[model samples]
Target: MTLPLEEDSRPPYLQAAEVLRTEILVGDLAPGSRLPSARLLQARFGVSSSTVQNALRVL
Candidate 1:
């Protein structure tokens, strides 16, 4: 899978966080929604497990 965010100055974690945050804000990912697994996020965003953790923590 490809990250929705790409080619920006922000770090990968921050980028991923923003993407997820946007989804939440727009109701695409509703409140109390279960996020994708860290492994899935890592695969989707091409980032490390720690990066996915950090992104999830941002929410």
Candidate 2:
């Protein structure tokens, strides 16, 4: 069997963050509602905490 693939391949945390932020801007996510917790996104996108923080910093 092939070795396991490494994650963090494309900086998805940043990408995901941008997407979520845009969604909020376009009223997709909406405001006041609690944003997806880092753990949720980390699990969903297989991204690291720092990467997520970087993306949020942009928001």
Candidate 3:
């Protein structure tokens, strides 16, 4: 769940969303399971609170 953000043209939120989306698609995150807290995600991905929120919005 600790995925480092890659340095690229994509936005940080999009990158975070992509990781989460992959986890969901691959069954790493089962449906109906509660997602990690925003704070936890921020720490995991080294992103800000808003970035985490935006990522969740994408999902």
Candidate 4:
């Protein structure tokens, strides 16, 4: 899937992880906030289940 960010060469999971990580680091995703479910993330990122899980694992 194509992401809004300009990173292209990375794996899907890594790409998703980088977006989430940046959001969290920049406080868009707060410390105590609950993240969306894996299924939701999968749908949102248009990626596979494994990719969503791998992205969550990066957090």
Clashes of each: 0, 0, 0, 0
Cα lDDT of candidate 4 equals 0.83
lDDT of each: 0.84, 0.67, 0.87, 0.83
**Cα-based lDDT at residue 53, candidate 2:** 76
Ranking of models by lDDT = 3, 1, 4, 2
Which residue pairs show collisions in model 2? none
Write candidate 2's Cα lDDT for 1-59 as tens digits: 11122543545555776677777999978689888887776666566777667777777
Q: Tens digits of per-residue lDDT for model 4 on 1-59?
A: 34654558788888999888988999988999998898888888888899889888877
lDDT of 3 by residue, 1-59 (tens): 54444556688898899998998999999999999899999998988899999999998
TM-score per candidate = 0.82, 0.64, 0.87, 0.82
Candidate 1 steric clashes? 0
| Over 4 Å off, model 2 | 1-13
Q: Write the per-residue lDDT of candidate 1 for residues 1-58, one digit (tens) a residue.
A: 5564556878778889988898889999889979889988888888889989988888
Model 3 stretches with alpha carbons more than 4 Å out: 1-6
Q: Which ten residues in a row have the lowest lDDT in candidate 3?
A: 1-10
